[model samples]
Target: MEHSEHTEPRPPGLIGSVSGLVKTTLRLVMSRVELALAELSEVRDHLVKLAVLFALAILAAWFAIAFGTATLVFLVWETLGWKILLILAAVFAVLAFVLVKSAMKLIRGGFLGMPATLAEIKADRDMLL
Candidate 1:
């Protein structure tokens, strides 16, 4: 009876393998960072647009509300007088508040980071551990 045992050859050196691994890991990190930057850029654009829209809306609403309130207060001054001014002021405050809250809602709708890339990095960390 004859028996044979075959073994694979040893790797040339450890440094080469380590260097290759490091390069690959760095490449992954760079790619993830790029993804994050792109995501941030998109989020920034959306936020900028939201900011501009809210600014215009707030300015226009304030002007219109102010003028309308002044007109109504003038008409009611002889009767209700100062009380009419207070009521108009309250109404204007409420509407302005609503406008601000709506803008906040829009701001909350988006995120400023690359969620997928972050998740991938977390997964990689776990795998390495």
Candidate 2:
């Protein structure tokens, strides 16, 4: 005759259950932070692009203003002398307009928001609740 011994698995006690929950919570928080960091890097890139574009726009606007003033002076002195300056001023104004429009489009594309991170956080909150 042979005897076999078997033990039933024990359910987690309060401390063990609480420890598991804490670990899970910490993991969730860490993952969310990592996601935010990744998204912030992308945001940094967008910011750099915006900065460069705005700088160019400002430069173009300055050129437009300067040329417009020059054109005004030329118009007062000689009518035909102002034509080239007026054309240059118009070109610079158009360049500034295009740069600002591109910047607006980038902003509209959600370059400033961490969409995925926000969605994940909302999901996590819903799950916990």
Candidate 3:
């Protein structure tokens, strides 16, 4: 006759349980950071677009003033002719204003920061507490 030995699984000690908790928390934080990084990348793309729009607005404004003044002085020397020059100036000014307003909206979009990351962290904190 032969006797068989049986082994039972041991329960996790304090140290093991603590280490597991730490590892899990670290993993959760890392995942949230990855999400934040992705959001920041998106913000970068938006910023580049806004910069281009701002540049265009400045160029339009410059041209409006330069050419409008030149036209008024050289071609539209008469008082009545000044109206057409002023109208052209007004049109370009409007275009520039629109572009500037668009850029401002992007600036205030509140996406420049890690908004999602902050929200996730807040939720995590709330859950933990």
Candidate 4:
């Protein structure tokens, strides 16, 4: 009798191949995260960009609301009487004040928090090997 070497059989079907692919994908993702951490050094410019974008958004919203209110007042004045239009203007003014106040609060909060957030991201990135 001749002695034969036993060979391991390969796993059959799509499930085994899929599991191997998933594991390889996860490893690649993990390596990319590591590389990103190592590569991320500065965020000051990024924070500044975000701040500018926030400011622009607030300015745009303010201008849009103001323009819309003006247009609405003009329409109302043309259709309704001046007295009713004045009352509407006053009501809109008060609402605008409230909205402005809220928006200012939000801007203040975002401005205060953004630097700290950027700092944290930088610090975390620094800690990565």
Clashes of each: 0, 0, 0, 0
Q: Which TM-score value belongs to model 3?
A: 0.65
Per-residue CA lDDT of candidate 4, range 77-125, in tens? 7667677667766887898799789868866775434454455557756
List of clashing residue pairs for candidate 4: none
- The candidate that wins on lDDT is 2
Q: RMSD to native for every prediction?
A: 7.4, 6.5, 5.5, 14.2
TM-score order, best first, reads 1, 2, 3, 4
RMSD of 2: 6.5
Clashes of 3: 0
Number of the candidate with higher TM-score, 1 or 2: 1
lDDT of 2 by residue, 8-115 (tens): 656889988998999998999999999999999999998898799878978997797788877666666565565766766687789879977986897788869999
* Window of ten residues with lowest summed lDDT in model 1: 106-115
Residue 126 CA displacement from its true place in model 3, Å? 1.0
Ranked by lDDT, top first: 2, 3, 1, 4
Q: Give each model's whole-structure lDDT.
A: 0.81, 0.84, 0.82, 0.69
Candidate 3 clashes between residue pairs 3 or more apart in a chain or in different chains:
none
Instruction: Please state the error at residue 32 of candidate 1 in Å.
Output: 0.7
After superposition, candidate 1 runs with Cα above 4 Å error: 1-12, 111-113
Query: After best superposition, candidate 1 residue 111: deviation in angstroms?
Result: 4.3
Best by TM-score: 1
